[model samples]
Target: MFLAILASNIRLVSHWSESRGVYDDICYLRQAHLFQRFGWHGLDTSLAHETDGYLAGKLRSIDFPNWNEPTRAPCHTEIADGSKWVMTPPPGTGFVLALFPEGFQVIPLYALANVMIGGFALYGLWRAREAGSLTLAALFGALSITFMINPAKASYSMAPTMVVCALAGLVTARLFVDEGRRRLMMIAAVGILLGLSASFRIANVILSAGYFLFFGLSFLIWRTRETFVAGLTLGLAFLVGLLPVFAANLVNSGHPLVSAYGGQDTAAPHLDPAVLRAYLRDTQFPLMVIACAWTALLWRFANHAGVRQLTLLVGANLALNLAFFATHPVFTPYYIIPILMLSLWTLLFAAVFTRGPVQGFDRAPPGRPRPPEMLSRV
Candidate 1:
C-alpha cells in the first residue's frame, strides 16, 4: 500500500511543469537554485530580479519552458537588501529542493523524499499499535499514504510537510506507550523529525510546542527521573534540528530567533478578518459533526493514552489554524489540510479505542516489553 501510494505521488510530481499555477512552488524552486549557488549566508537576488520583470524577461525559454509573463508572480520581502530580497516564506522546503540540480525536474525528487518520510510515519504507527491488531496498523498505513498522495495537493509544498507532521505526531504518541531507553530514543527521533517539519513550514513549530507541553505535563504528573530525562533530551534534539533555520535567520535577518516571515505584513487585505470568518464558518459544520462523535467515543475510553494524545495533537493543530485565521484573515485550503489529516487520524484512533481490547492479545506481548519506566499509571 505504501509503495503504491508513493508510486502515485512520483507520477504526479514528475508531470508537473516547472512553472505551475501554485503560488509558492516556483518560489521554492528558485530559492533552491539560490541556495545551490550561495548557501544560507547570502540572499538570493533572483527574487528581486523576478519582481522587477528583469529575471523573467532574461530567464531562458529553455530553462523555464512554462514561464508565463502575464501570470508570473514573484514574491519578495523588504527586510533584506532590495537587490537581495528573499521570499517571505520559510527556506526549509527550498533547502530540501536545493539537493536537486538546477533545471532538473524536482517534483519526483520531492515526492521520493516525502515517501521516505511517510514510510517512517507508517513504521511509527505500526510500532505503536497494540498487539494482535495488524488490521489497525494496516488501516492507518493505508490512510496515511492516501492522505499523502491526495490529488488536491499535487504541486504544493504543504504535501511533504504534512507527511512529516503526521510522522512526528505519531512518534510523539508512541512515546506514551514505550519505556526506558526505547522511549528516550524515540524522544530524540521525534525532536529531530519535528524540527525537520518546522523547516518546511514554520507553523509546525506550534505542533512542536504542543508536543513539548504534552511530554512536559506527563513528566510533571509522574515526577519520574526517566520522564524528566526524556523530556530534556527531546527538547535538546529538537533545538539541534532547528539550528539551521536559526542560523539562517541570524545571517539573513540579523536576528537568530526572528524568522523571514516576521518581515511580511500578514495584516494585508486578502488575509483580513472577513475571509477568516468565512473559512471559519465553512470548517465549523464538519468540525461540529466530528466533535459530537469524538466526544461520545472519548467518554467510553478516556483511560486510553492514545485517545488522549490524538485529541491533543488534532486540537493543537486546529487551534493553530483558528488562531492564524483570526489574526490574519487571508485563507488557503492547504492551511486546513494538517487539521484534516489529524482529525482523520483521531477518528481512526477513536474507532480502535471504542472497540475495547482485541481478544487474546496480551497486555505486554513477547516482542514488545512494557518496561518498568513506562507510564503505566498515566
Candidate 2:
C-alpha cells in the first residue's frame, strides 16, 4: 500500500509538472544539482548567495543559455518581497530537493519522500493502537494516508515537515496516555522532531509552543516527577534541534528569529488594516469555522485520551492561525501546517471511534465484558 501510494504521488507530481510548466522545479533541480556537486561549499554558487554579476559569470562559464536578458532574482527573494512574485518553492521543498542526485527534478522526489514519511506515520499509529481494535487501527491508518497524501498547493512542500511532526505527535500521545516506561525518551524525541520541523519552517514554532503548553499542563495536573523530567528533556532536545536554524538565521539576518527571506510586515506594504480585516472576514473565518466544527465532532466521539490530545491539537492550530492573521502581514498555506496535522488526528480519532461501536468488531474473545465500547470514552 505504501509503495503504491508513493508511485501514485510520483505520477501525480509528474503530471502536474508537465501541465504547469511555470512551476519552480528548475530552481529546485538546480539547487539539488549544486548540492550534489559541492556539498556545503556549493552554497556560495547558488543564486541566493551570488550577486547578479557572479551569477551571470557562472552561467557564462557553464555555457548555459541566457535568453538575452538579466536573470531574475532567486525565488526566495520573490517570496520575501511579496510583490508580483507571490508563490515560490517553500523552504522545506528546497531541503528535499537538496537530497536528490544531480540532473534529477526534485518535485517527484519530494512527493515520493512524503509518501514514505506518511507511511512511517501510519506505522506509528498502528503500533500505538489498542489491542482490541487492530482492524480499526488499519482503517485509520489508510484514511490518514489518503487524507495526507495530497500534493496540490503547498502540501507537497510541507509534507516532509508535517510527517515528522505527525510522527512526533503520535508517539507523544502514546507515551503520555499509555504511561510507557520510555515516555521520557519519547517525549524528548518528539521535541527534537518538532524543532527540526520548525527549522525547516519557522512558522512551526507556534505549534511547538502549543505542544509545550499542553504537555506542561498535563504534567502539573498529573503531579509526577517523571512528567517534569520528560518536559525538561523535551525542552533540551528542542533547543539542540533548533541550533541549526538559529545559526543560519543569525548568520543571514542579524537576529536569531529573523528569516533570511525578510520580516513579515516588511513583505506586504500595501496590506492596509481594512484589507487585512476583509481577508480575515472572508477566507480565515470560514476555514476556522469548518475546522472547529469537524474537530469538535471528532473529539466528542473519540477515546478520552485521544479526545484530549486532539482537542489540544485543534485548539492550538486555530489559536495560532488567529494570532498570525492578526499580527503577520503575510500568510501562506504552509503556515497552516499545524492545522493540517491536527486535521489528520481528528479524522483518525473519528475513524477509531466510529469503528468501535460496530457489533462484529466489538465482540470479544469470550471473556472481557465487551471491551467497553470505545476504550475509556470521555
Candidate 3:
C-alpha cells in the first residue's frame, strides 16, 4: 500500500513543476529560496523581485510553451507598497518546500516521505484496533489510500493534506502509546508536529486550541500529575516549534500574527448564511453539522480517554473552520478537503477504540491492563 502510494505520488509530481499550470506551488518555491538565502527579513527584500520574475517569465511561460498566453494569468495581489506579493495562500506549504533543495527531485522526495509517514500512521491505526479485525483495518487503510491519490487533496505540494496526515499520526500515537514518560515524549512530538503543520497553514492553529482544550479536560477528568506534565510539555513544545513562523511573520509584516493576505478583505460579509450552507452542501463538507452528529454518535462507544478527547478535538476543529470560512468571501472545493480528510480519520479512530475488546487484542503484559486503561488512569 505504501509503495503504491509512493510510486503514484512520485509519478504525478515528476510531471508537474514550476512550468505547469499556474498554482500556489511556485510561490512556495520562491518563498523557500528566499528563506534559504536570507531568512524572513530576506522575504521582505525579495518578494517583489520574485513576483516580478514569476509574473513576467514563469507565469507567462504557461506550461513552458512557446507562445505566452496572457488571458490565463494568475491573479496575484501585492502589498507593502508593492514590495511584497501575497499568494493568498498559507505559508506553511512554502516552509515545507523550503526544507528541500529546489530541483525536480524535491517534489518526488517530499511525495515519497509523505507517503511513508501516512503509511506508518495508517499502520498504527490498524494495529491499535481493538476489534482485531484485519478486514476492517484493511478497509480503513484503503480509504486512506483512496484519499491520498486525489491530486487536489494530496498531489499538490500544499499544506492541507500534509497537515491531515500529521494530525492523524498524532491521534494514532495517542491511541496506541502507553502512559508513561514515553507517552509524555510522544505527546510532545505530537505537539511539535501540530505546530509544524500550522506553520504551513495558519488556520490549523485552531486544532491546537482543540488539543489544548482536550489536555485541560484530561487534567480535570483524570487529575494525574502525568497528564498535567504531558499537557504542559506538549504546549511548550508546540509554542517553541512555532517561534520560527512567528519570527518570519514579524520580520515580513511587522506583526507576528499578520500574514501576507491579512491586509485583504477577509471578514467582510460576501454571501448569505443560506448561500454558504448551500455551497457547503454542494462541496460535501457540512463539517459543523456532520461533526455534531458524529460526536454524539461516537462518544458513547469511545473506550479510551485519548479517543474520546480526539473525537471532541476533531469536532471542535471542524466547527472552528466552518465558522471561519463561512465568514470569508470566497469558497473553493479544495479548501474543505483537509477538513473532510480529518473527519474521516477521526471517524476511523472512533471505530478502532469503540470496537470493544477482542481476546488477543485486549491483552497487555501478563496481569497488566491495556494501554487504554492507563489512559483512563490519567
TM-score of each: 0.70, 0.66, 0.72
* Model 3 misplaced regions, further than 4 Å: 1-10, 36-45, 48-55, 63-91, 99-106, 125-136, 151-164, 171-177, 216-231, 269-297, 346-378
Residue 306 lDDT, candidate 1, scale 0-100: 58
- Score each candidate by Cα lDDT: 0.60, 0.54, 0.57
TM-score winner between 1 and 3, please give it.
3
What would the per-residue lDDT of candidate 3 be over residues 1-378, giving only the tens digit for each residue?
Answer: 645665666676566555556555555655566666666544442344453454446545555343243223342355556555445444556555666776553455456555654664566456564445355555545545544445344334443444455465446435442455477667777677667666666655655665677778878999999779878988998887677667666656667776656655555755567757656576345544655676666666666675666667677766766666676666655555555556655565556545645534534678775687555654
Give the TM-score comparing model 1 with the true structure, all chains together: 0.70
Where is model 2 poorest over a 10-residue stretch in terms of lDDT? 81-90
By lDDT, the candidates rank as 1, 3, 2
lDDT of 1 by residue, 1-378 (tens): 767776776777677666545456666776676677667643433343344343353234335543544234455465544334456556777777777776673665557665765675466455444553346556656656655545335545666676665656555555543344587788898888877766777776655655677678879999999769878998999998887677767755677797767766665524465665666676443643564456455545667665566566455545555565456555555555554554555444444433445444447767786666453432
What is the lDDT for 274 in model 1? 68
Look at candidate 3 and tell me the lDDT of residue 188.
72
Q: Report clashes for each candidate as comma-separated counts.
A: 3, 0, 2
On lDDT, the candidate that comes out on top is: 1
Superposed Cα deviation of residue 365, candidate 1 (Å) = 20
Q: For model 2, what is the C-alpha lDDT against the true structure?
A: 0.54
Alpha-carbon RMSD of each model: 6.9, 7.2, 6.3
